[model samples]
Target chain A: MSAPSLFLTVESEGGAVCLRLAGVLDYDTSDELAARADACIEQGPRAGELHLDCEKLRLCDSTGLSALLMIHRRTTARGITLFLDNPPPFMERMLSVTGTRHLFAPESGKARQSCPDEVRETTD
Target chain B: MAPPPGIPVTRTGERQASGVWSTAPHPVLESAAGGVLTEVNPAASRLLRGARPGVRLADAAPAWLARADQDLRDRIVNGSGDTDGGASGWIGARSFEAHPSRSGNGNVVWWLVEDTDRRRAEEALATERERTAFLTEASHVLLSSLNTDRCVSATARLASEYLAEAAVVVSPARGGKLPLAHAVGGQDVVRSLVAADPSQLPGLDEALQGFPPVASRWIDPAALPAWMIPEGYTGTITSVVITPLPGQGVPAGALVLLRSGGQFTENEQIFARLFAARAGAALSAAHLYAEQSAITHTLMQDLLPPRLHRVNGVEFAGGYRPAAAQERVGGDFFDVHHAGSDGDDSSLVVLGDVCGKGLEAAVLTGKIRNTLQALVPMADDHQRMLGLLNGALLNSHHTRFATMVLASVRRTDHVVRLRLTSAGHPVPLVVRADGRVDEVGTHGTLIGALPDIESRTAETVLRPGETCLLYTDGFTEARGGPLGDEMFGEERLKRALSECADMPAEAVVERIQMLAAQWVRGGGHDDMAVVAITAPRTNHLSAVDGHTRGRYTA
Candidate 1:
């Protein structure tokens, strides 16, 4: 069977960067996501926030989670707040299961309202 | 006088007699039947060097032309001169075709047409074809093997056979010594490592460093060092061409071509460079492959799972398969470490899966195994051990995490007591002698992801003929089936383990692996690992006779 592919699109608005991740994010595609995140970070200092839109993300394997953690480490080093805009249920469970939800906490109230189920699931 | 029927008479009427015979562009001569020169045209005198009316044909013309005139006269005297006389010979450096016509008085008029240009062109075409064929064959031979030594030898042999009298392929210096493969003519290649300096020759060092070659004329053959020429070569080296064998970024080597005769033409030198390019690429590939394989082999030797055996009276068996079939080791790993000398009777068995796959994951797996090995002294407290491991991971630079299950097994009386704990990993499954399967109640966050980790340890006892199985998520997450996308879920694994209730530890592990492999036939998979801890059934009949089958006396 053909493997699933990952696509990334980056946009800068109001001094903030938003990287949209779609399709599978497993071993084969994790490096690409990490590279894109590095490229976004290399675009000089932004409005202290980097948002990752995961609304269309289909799957995130352990390696994919590791890439997100790496990105988190990079942004934290630069004092940039990172947020997961709209994580799916599986990603939320993965974060909760690994106990890394606090590391990538979404700061915006709109993001929190969009992922209310994710917050409730993590709390449970 | 009418010209011979086969000959073209270009000049007409008044000038036809003398003009056609004298003013012709081709060299013409008239010789008598007695081998004497009767008349010589101006063209003939200019082309033949020494031609006069009284001189003998043999003294004025080349031997082949003179012999052809004598043979024609003999044929005419024998009344059989029906065939036209034609002969080809070289006068000085120029070649010519001699055509003869006989007159009524038996004097033969000879016409010589120069064909030097046509002959040289044919010779050039033949040489070009030969070089093309040699290059095609050289490519095939050079690429036949990915062995560095074999590639070096092939390059030397091909250059000697076609381009020069002898050749030497000198590899990049290693450990202050250069490896050389030398060949002469069609003889076997000889390889040796010599400590000779490359700077002895003007361009040798630069060529070895991947610089463009110096012109062949600039390198004097008298400057060749003793090591540069192959042994037993008797001829004096008249010319040498040193060309760099360029590789991927770095230089692979240098090719030294030696000739005892004339210097190489510009075309020949260009062809030699082309040949070196092909040889360099093949040699570089071979070197790269050797280096990579050596590295992978060394790393795999350390990371591959150990062979499980009976440890501390508890039967232990493990099976592991990497994600890719061609790969040897991946993220999933298992280890059985005998209990430390801390008065603990239990042996620690750890099964874990690091994030990601292939060599990167295997490296992390190695680190985790080493850390756990060092922490075996604290096997009694599972939660404390996990917390320490979590801190170690968090302090390190790697952001990747791992899921793992640790089981401390102790055999007592007729049962095996076990303390099992899971850190964001699949819980251990217990299979009873009555074909009942139960999942241990233990869960926690994965290691390396968070600072503070929480884990609950569950204690259990396995009676005789019961087994406890700890596996990685790769077992339940294997995606395959008739549809090729269905997961081999936990339910399926539990059912498969239920059928192995009274089996030996090795048999149980093998059965689970077989079922999973069948479910994911030829499909992509994550790395899967399983370790089984079984309580051995007492063999009551083993003391009476060694041949009889033992009946469980639990």
Candidate 2:
């Protein structure tokens, strides 16, 4: 009833667009934001520079995880990198256990150094 | 006799100094009684021009040298062990103090200082390593578990590895000969000793029967199978301990550990037993979860609308998503039923949202769903059909209230008479071909909330391209939205309908769902039941559409 409660913000930093997600990301919002991300990459962004800011994002469940997987796949296929910046620990653990840590690869490489067995597949 | 006191920080920094600390050669003071220089560390040796290990404190520095530096004499009179280990007071290289033990039978005094730096670093490293190992094991199990068995076996292996147990066996609590559920290592010299005649394994069946695994001392080595005692594994094996699982009715099963030298301590037995109990419980839960998911899935697939009811002129698209979250099962139903034998006269469209979830909710859903399906064909108006469903819900006290909307769409040429009956359901959003949206506000008290439900019916007209949408609270009260703070009021829904009015029935539902998503974010906060239907514009399309029912989307 109230203009779909979610609001979107896009910020540009050093030639990269940092998409800040301000609300819950589940089944209801998956398609719209996913669509938005897809369009952004289509408009041309370098790999590893297209970052998603989820500092305020409140929830991330299995459905949201699946949606993220979809975006990850779509972005990688186009040679564009997708970064999840400072996601809440809940999402971080979900991604870790699901072995999608490679998607949100920590810049410092701390956890990654502990796990050398991360299987890499060039799958889009 | 009280031991003479001046102690050194450590042997590492030996140099010349006075007062038992030195960076340079200075003076060494003595007690007033004999001018005794009782404490001398290696640094004092430097004052003696490198006095070797056997050099006594008095020999390293004579009292005659102390009169030169009176501060050295004062320290000789005072003895305290509080100085930090590494940092010794830097006087001259004349002396280093003798260090005394902090606890019992204090015998050795040396120039060595305590190393808190190294000790703290080691402890911190150990703590971090422990956490990393735990996370590693958790991730391994979480990502890989596919079925209940794999879940237990994998996690059991992880637990066994974590607990560093000799064995971890997973066995069905139900009938199974192997008392061992899973095993790692034990007295058996063989690797992965599976199928061990069940009788050969120590404390096997005995533990399953509630007795603990026979302690190592109680078990006679001669009694074991010849294969269990291989030549090389003799001493490394400490003892064998068997622990019983907690839950009852488990087929005779227990965890058996093998140690060669020592018997299991009381605490170890308690821990082994407790860990096994939790493992079994978790296993049972995982099994139940898998079973329930399979059944709920199969049942929903088996029953779908056989065909959409055919009335002259309309298009329709409907979607249903069962409460997908593990905690709940939503029982929401919708159907377009026609009582008339001919294609033109009348049809009833019913949609309802049942309260609660799980096997019980599913059962009630099936009952109400089937009962209404049977009752609709006999009813002339929507109200009569709904009253039948309400009676069925009232007959059972298993669940609280359910909201339902029943609509009768009748057409005899241009005028399509729509009679709506509601038992506490969302008012259907009506959209015109001109993109004008309005709420059909056809709502009534929710059924089963109270004994006597006051069902209400409203009449409306469906001209050429006008469509009406019926949906459950799941859509409006999505997780991220303000549903919990306030009801997802009908006003907002009506506005959405008016904004996207000209869309087809399916698109309108999809868009409304999208709008709900936009309002609440991505969460399917509750179970959603949605339907959108347009009165067919032509007799031909209506006739063709009548043969098909609602579609199921993944």
Identify the candidate with maximal DockQ.
Answer: 1
Best by TM-score: 1
DockQ of 1: 0.39
DockQ of each: 0.39, 0.01
Per-residue lDDT of model 2, residues B1-554, tens digit only: 12234544333222332334443232222222233333443444544553444443344444334332233334334754332232232224222332232211121233323244555576678855774676555555634554655644554455445543445553533443332334343222122334455456556557656564566567554455543333344446556665665443553245555555567766556555556665555555666668777887777664443344234445556666666655344566677766566555567677777655555556666777778778867656556666666676664322244667887777655545677766666677677778777667565655543344455578787675678888886666564555534435466777778876555566777887777767656444567778777764443433334444334334
Q: Which one wins on lDDT?
A: 1
Error of 2 at A26 (Å): 24
Clashes of each: 0, 54
- Supply the TM-score for candidate 1: 0.74
Query: Given candidate 1, what's the lDDT at residue B258?
Result: 96
User: RMSD to native for every prediction?
Assistant: 7.6, 23.0
lDDT of 1 by residue, B1-554 (tens): 12234555332222245456686777878788678887677888998877977799999888999899888888888988464868887999998888777665667778788888987898899988997888788888888888999999999999998889999999999899989988999578999899989999899999999999998999999999888788788889999999999999999999999999899877888989999999999999999988988888999999999999876667899999888865788999999987747555679999998997777787888889999998998888988889888887784466789999999988776679998998988789999999999999887878986666788889899998899999987888899988999989889999999999889999999999999999999898888999999997765544533224456476
Q: Per model, how much of the real contact set is kept? A: 0.56, 0.00
